[model samples]
Target chain A: MTGADRPGEFELIARVFAPLAGEGAFGLVDDAAVLTPPPGEDLVLTKDAVVAGVHFFPDDPWDAVAQKALRVNLSDLAAKGARPLGYLLGLGLPDGWRTEDAEALGRGLALDQDAYGLRLLGGDTVRSPERLMLSVTVFGAVPAGRMARRGGATPRDVIVVTGTIGDAALGLKLRLDAGLSGRLGLADADRDHLLDRYLLPRPRSAVAGAVLAHAGGAMDVSDGLVGDLAKMAAASGVAIRLDASRVPLSDAARAAIAADPALLRTALGGGDDYEIAVALDEDDCDAFVDACRDAGVAATPIGRAEAGRGVTVVGTDGAVMDLGAGSYAHF
Target chain B: MTGADRPGEFELIARVFAPLAGEGAFGLVDDAAVLTPPPGEDLVLTKDAVVAGVHFFPDDPWDAVAQKALRVNLSDLAAKGARPLGYLLGLGLPDGWRTEDAEALGRGLALDQDAYGLRLLGGDTVRSPERLMLSVTVFGAVPAGRMARRGGATPRDVIVVTGTIGDAALGLKLRLDAGLSGRLGLADADRDHLLDRYLLPRPRSAVAGAVLAHAGGAMDVSDGLVGDLAKMAAASGVAIRLDASRVPLSDAARAAIAADPALLRTALGGGDDYEIAVALDEDDCDAFVDACRDAGVAATPIGRAEAGRGVTVVGTDGAVMDLGAGSYAHF
Candidate 1:
């Protein structure tokens, strides 16, 4: 049974969301939630939304859908070098939604809330006549004037990325075309790994401290690393030179690229890869990498900032590679 | 041209939304916005969502839809006695949406942002395959432990409501069945007045300071006055005695009720009247009303809280009136 089959909106909220409400939520009865500001800290706010058939497969499990809705915003907070506080959820469910779906979504939120040390603040649930849409507004806190910014990079800054990239993009391709896995000669485990990466993102929150301490600029790579790095470079009035061969890829993405060199474009230009990309002074790069390693996060040097404009990717042949349609665009 | 006719998402944000970005928004380029904490204050958060065909007519103007989406959340902040700070918007538009629609939505948001003394902090826009959906998360600030709450009412507290009730409900009826206006013997101007109230709410934000200073408990009447009062009574563990004849009604609503006595139930039991319902000590009632009158706001006393449970409406004949389906339920 889904929440649609359960009862009215208020009852559904009590059953499915009240358990996740934090102390500030007033058991979801109050019109608004209150958050006592963390002493001497600035508040960081970010909002991300996902729509059915647009951001996820229509048949994706409710739990994974809910997790993605939250993790995407968490990735933003992580990139900002802020600690999680809580979040407000706005859900528009299509008519006749299942009770089981709401329960699964609640459980998924609980799983992540525990892992991230956050809680549900308050939210509004409404009926949508069309597709399901979920929007999450997350709050975090950081020392005043110290949050990581995207426009602080300068020439000679080392471009570093946490964890492997391109896996989720490749995963999306495989999910769209199952035959691609066999075409790439991927093993079963490798196929599962790619699919898992697409289904759920592991936000690079563990290395946030290191980024805030040592990096000059940072952002989450949700819309293709190449495009996002280009944006960062443009915002900071600098250029970036990336070594295409040095761009981190999982074993499955590597196998796919080896089978079809054109797949490399998909790996580099596809979005939904929730990795943290940062730029720092060359001297601070090693210390940041060491700190990430100490925190059990993989840190890789993929590029460097330069005194120019836009992003240039040098292929293995030592020539600039032209990336058509440089990023994933929703519009 | 609508935003769908526009080139890309980033360009859309830059052209349509960047101008509305607040000082803390970083031009909508950064992953998250940073807000400096107000000195010695707690942060208040509220979220509300509106969907096409559910919350408003599918053909409603983009600007009105946008205004309703934001103002609904603002109404919540007003009920909580929090001063507006900023808001994040999440919009989902169907493919091929026109550039004119996008521009109209932006204009609408700017109008309300300026009116409410707030700014756009950050937001996300994505494509939806079906109906348009909008979600807004608003933030505000209030002195520590001084925000109005819903569960603070006690016996002998007077129930006061801002503005008139049931105008929106009657307006909705007129909109749905144009012939109803003639049946209710409404004047041309009265019909337009009712329709306007239904289309746009005048949130009682101006009286927020007075509410915080005088009211023991408060909530916005978005879900019908009688039902919402019942909820407050339940939450505060007190009984409410309301004089049904004393419930404030707009001139248009009163005219309709005079033509058809049955319409009185519609006025008292209908929803979407964004008036603030507050509870205060009887002694403070006169002063609160005086303050509101001084501020050019209409406020009226309608009932009183008692040491009991549930809500009882005493009709003009001195007998409890039974209200069937006391509130609107989305589910």
Candidate 2:
């Protein structure tokens, strides 16, 4: 049947979301998400939505769409130094969407929820016109005093980040413009790295607690390192300076940049890395790095927070260099 | 600009949802809905979604759409004997939706949130293709011992309902098929009464509290009186028998039904009236009626919860008739 003939809200919800049960918790049929934060832990809740076209390709695979929707929200919780608890989903599907597609998307969500140790609580479903939208509200918890915010950095704080940057930006560029693919003369290795970064981003939650426990301020790099760090600096009332040479890049990214230095510009400005950016005092940086190593997560020192406004990236010779404008802007 | 040319996710959210200020104590900028259930009170939360074409006409007025979306959710909270506190809304607008239309819808939501003393906590906005979808999660609080559940009704409980029923169904029928307009030949008063029920529905939150405080079990009449009452009986593991003659109707309803007796079926099976259907002990019925009288809300004894499995409607002559089919089914 066509989407217009699809089942109504209740039936569609029962078919799509009801089967993804939670582990070690209250029933999903309950009126609200019945999770109770563990003692000495504070609840951390964040919500985000992925719109058709804006957040994903209209023709993006249903499984990827579902996973991305859940993952993006999880990344927010991770940035806050919280462990996953459960989530509520609100899905708006067009009349033309197939039941199989919806089911596939649900399975993807179920997979991530199970993988992350989060239960699928409850959600609402409705019919729309053409595009599909998913709104996810995640609940997590962090030990008291361990939750991270972007406003806690001090002038002497050392800046650190998890994982490499800019691969996702390259991935998006490749996906959107075929001309870029031809220009880079990309091999399968470079193409795969970019694709993986764009499609599946890993949220760095394990080291988040350690960073928040020891560091002064932190945020996730959603909108490119430069733009997001700029936000963190503004929120923390400090200036930040990045050591351009220390910024980590995957071997594939380095190779791509070698082919064309402009690729470095993309890595610096392109976002969706889901990496945590933290600021800690110089004396605490070593301990924080040790904590990350103990957690089996990578941590790299890339910059330092200083007393000023705006962010500046300095070369090895201490000369200020311009990182091309970072991240996508709507307006 | 065409929706295809619209900016990315961050831009869309900033334009549509982020800047809209709400009146909650913590407002829309928080991590989670901060609800302080009054001391000695119980918290109740319910979520529901209204899909275009499924729950309403695609062309329904924006304010009416907002009203239906909010009232339906509030109806659920009211049935739990909770006073409305606030709601979190997740809205999905079609790609072609006008910005002004969205703002008008937002104003409608703001108006209701203010009227009900519920703040719009936080919500997500996404772009969809065909229809506009609204998913609302409402929270409220009731006296600890007075919250109602459908499973609490025992056999032999007296069934009661507040307010007149079926006007919404007739209104919808008239709106969809103008041929029915001439058949009923409704006067301006009759037309206005039916239309009012469609445009604006009041959740019986106050009446619900009185019932929950005294009645054995309760639910709001959403899927028509006959269908919803049957659901209550099913949940309570009891049967129901309605006194058809005692079903209250407005004078306009009576006249319209007289012109087309078939209208009674619509009245009996029509949904979206937002009335409270309650089961109370036989001994408590008089006291309950007195309480409703003091509260200035009408309370009518309509049926009894019996020991059998299905519903039996007793006619004016005391003959048992089968209301074999009644209710508004979305699917």
Candidate 3:
């Protein structure tokens, strides 16, 4: 289809997005919105775009796609020790988009708004020729100078991660190679768990307060464990020594890894696992873990940061392992 | 190309966009950045996306396309009576994208960042697969409760506009139909002026203070005068009577319109003119105009708002003109 051939972007936004707008949004009627700051709070901002067939399957449920987009951005906030305020959504409809699809997308956002205690702000919708794309810019707020920054990781800092790793990666493999699920002899529950994790990330938002309280450095692992840790290490001007054996794994991921040891590389390097990774002083590691546990998020000691640069991955053999092609290259 | 097939996005960002990063961006390494609210000011937020082939020709200059994307968002903030602080950019590169093209796009943004006195905060760059798309979210600062909202227009308010009305519309036609320029007997300078206006918007950012001080309602005219006025009228619960004969036009637009009277319809109803349109009390109108003039931007009288509904356009013949299509409609 040619450009601007959709029915009406304005009407869709009015019907589907206006009701979810923040009080400051003026129901999306004004040229722009006035965002009055809550006194003494600093705002946090991040933008991540998901293009069709790149970040997700085209046939994925619209609501789930919406939730995934929202959750991934919130995952960043959670790692930064911020809580949600609102978000602006940029949705580009592919040709042949239907009104019901828009409605379903709106339903997903409305449900998340209630669940997350944030409101929709405002955004734009345009025509993307071949595929649907969603670009989300989420706003979050934290107390002054309290955000857990990536550069703060120092020598002797213990690395911590929330929830299990590798399920999303394995699930993605399952998604791409349909026969892989059966080849791995995966159980029905195992298959579902991995698929759920890949399709929808469980952002560790509940642990935001804990990160602010106890962690010195933090970030969400959207680009696999090994590569994301390497990024944090490089950013912090420190070295990360990650013990693959200590890396937490779910039953589903463990089952698949045990059946096929080669899949471990995929699990460790493949991305889309939206979990919080934190670096803290040795004295605060246990407390940070306990704090996250209090939030019902599993926190595990995965590595340590040293005064050097770059990242080192240790195999179960207690020796350095070469993690060729560290993470999913798509991002 | 398949999903995630592009070269490293992280490296590209660190090399190009990182240099333009705001102080809080942490060189684009942190999961998110902190935005400290300027003392005692309300923040204004606006997002507008331009898709290739939809917003402009795919082969448009990368720098001009980048500038257009940035200017459009800034235009909204200007109309809202806010001054720029910084912005986030979401760029989607098409298949077979080159590194040189990315550098050229960066050069464009770099030039505008200097021109507009704003910093690049943080944003996302993804593979769009087929077409390029740029989404910009701009932030501006306005003193508390000083925003010029579209809903604040009142009956008896005089409408004022900054800069000429419809040169960009005619310019777009000139761009699309090269032969039309010859038929219209257009001067080279006139043709260049129209195309320049269409390709790169000159946002009336200098008049922000004037808008805040004198206007009751305001918006940028990206969607033609007639349609935009109608929107303001509806939002403000008033009626707008536009004096079409008084609408300011560039020499080129006037020449073209005089040559073909039918082109008047395209001029009035077509859009892409990024001038500020403001509604002020009759007494404030002249002062607002004078203030804009002092900023080196011309402000012209367009019409008046009345206690009624919708918008009416009166031609030089002193009769209501039927604007068959209220706007360019592509937006």
Candidate 4:
């Protein structure tokens, strides 16, 4: 059948998205989904969008594209110390989009929904004239008044991060410069690791309870750590001093940076590393680390908040490092 | 300055969207907005998207585009018998978008936020390679277990619709066929009214409380009253018989139809009216109408639900009308 004669919007939704809907979704037929928060809980709301060719290569796998769209929003919830409840997806498909690709996208979303213990709540699908764009509005729940806020960090707070940073940035470099992976003298496995990190983010949701219990301020490190940290510091009305060596890097990133020290700037300032950066009292560091460890997440102390402004990154030689354009801005 | 040198994303958000942020929004700095639903309430969630060429003309006013995006989602909440709490926006701007246009979009959103008693919570902005697109996910609140569902209608329920319909469909015709307006012998004001109805939808949020209290089932008439009624009928397992002569029409629409007798099918089947269509018991119809009247809304009883499936529209001639397509569908 021609595109117009194919399954219409409602039939497509029923065949693809209906099974993903949870109890509150009214099987995707109702105008709106009903969500009853647990007693005394607060709803955490966040929205993120990914467009083909910008957020991901247009040629990327449809499943990975769908996963990346949902995972990025889930990363925000993880930073805010909230557990995933459900998400609403806004999908804009190009005119030539195939039913098989749509099904693949649904399968990708379904996989992540099962993995994250969340369900589709409600959404809208429309036809676009050009590129495919996906927007996800994630709903999460945390105990009342207990969500981590970016403005809560104070002087002397320990700055910590979950998982490695800069892998995605390096992966992006490899994606844009295919030969760079070999130039960095990296193993095949290391190259694959960086590429996977760029393609799919493992949001640190498992440690959200611990982060809520201990973090004073937090945010997901999406737009490169240096810029994101500067934002967090500005929001908290404090200064942050990062030991550049302490910013966790995967083996692939380390190999690339070692091969060309100039690559460190990209590692520090590239975007799409969906790791959680948080600040807490120095005294609570050990407990938070232990908690994250128990939750199967690796937590590392990267720096400290100080009673000043902006961000300062120190090199291994104890000299301040000048990193140009500390973060990614999509202006 | 060129587009690349224009205000960065954060600066743009601060100058425009930050002012629209309400309490618990953390001034748009926090990763997620925290929403505390009033005790014994259920949170309602809905999302809608509009693309540049698909939903609006590429050259449409940025403010009107923004308003259309938010208003469409608000229409969903109104149908579900919920009060607007807040909304999250995901905006994808083309590379050459002007700063002034961005500000205009923000102003448009702010105007509606105030008009609707909602606020901006959180959102993400990204760069699109081609056309501008916007997605809005709205949150509303209703008393626990009181949300209007699509499956609540029963046999013998009276079918009612709030405000006028068909103006938008004709407005769309006027939009696409500029010559058709004069052919329909519409006055300048009537022409403008039809165009405005097509450009901006006034969601029936004013009657939500009354709808929740009195309606058995309801939905906003977005995809034409005929098709949307069929959907409600299928969901509620009841047949809907709509008297075409009783379907409310604005003066502008009436003028157009008077000039063109064949416009009736377009009036009943064209989309984008955004009025609420509801079902209630015949015994409660008068009280519901009075309640809507008190709220400054006009309610019209058009038909009744019966034991069957699908929808049958009776023409002014007392004959069944055959609308080739029951509703507008985006495939």
Candidate 1 residue-wise lDDT, B220-270, digit = tens: 999888899998998899999988888998888888888988888888889
Candidate 4 lDDT over B232-276, as tens digits, reads 999999999999999999998899999998998888999999999
TM-score of each: 0.98, 0.84, 0.97, 0.98
Q: Every model's DockQ, to 2 decimals? A: 0.78, 0.31, 0.66, 0.85
| Number of backbone collisions per candidate | 15, 8, 0, 1
For model 1, state the Cα shift of residue A129 in Å: 2.3
Candidate 2, B1-331: lDDT as tens digits: 3565554545555465555445432334232333345556655656677878878888877777887788888887777677887666777676577666766676777777767777766666655556677877676777764567766678889999888888888878877887776778888888878877877788776666587678788888888888888777777889999998899888878888889886887888888788888898999998888888787788899989989786777877799765655866543
lDDT of 1 by residue, A226-281 (tens): 99999899889999999998998888888878888998888888888999999999
Candidate 4's TM-score on the B chain: 0.98
Query: Which 10-residue window in model 4 chain B sums to the lowest lDDT?
Result: B1-10
Give lDDT tens digits, candidate 2, residues A36-137.
456666556566677777778888888889898888878877777778887777776755777778878978988887778787766666554556778777
Better of 1 and 3 by TM-score: 1
Number of the top-ranking candidate, with DockQ as the measure: 4
Ten contiguous residues minimizing lDDT sum, candidate 3 chain B:
B1-10
Clashing pairs in 2: A3-A95, A128-B131, A129-B129, A129-B130, A129-B131, A130-B129, A130-B130, A131-B129
Candidate 3, TM-score of its B chain: 0.97
1 or 2, which is superior by lDDT? Answer: 1
**lDDT (CA) for every model shown?**
0.89, 0.74, 0.88, 0.90
> Per TM-score, what order, best first?
4, 1, 3, 2
Clashing pairs in model 3, backbone N/Cα/C closer than 3 A: none
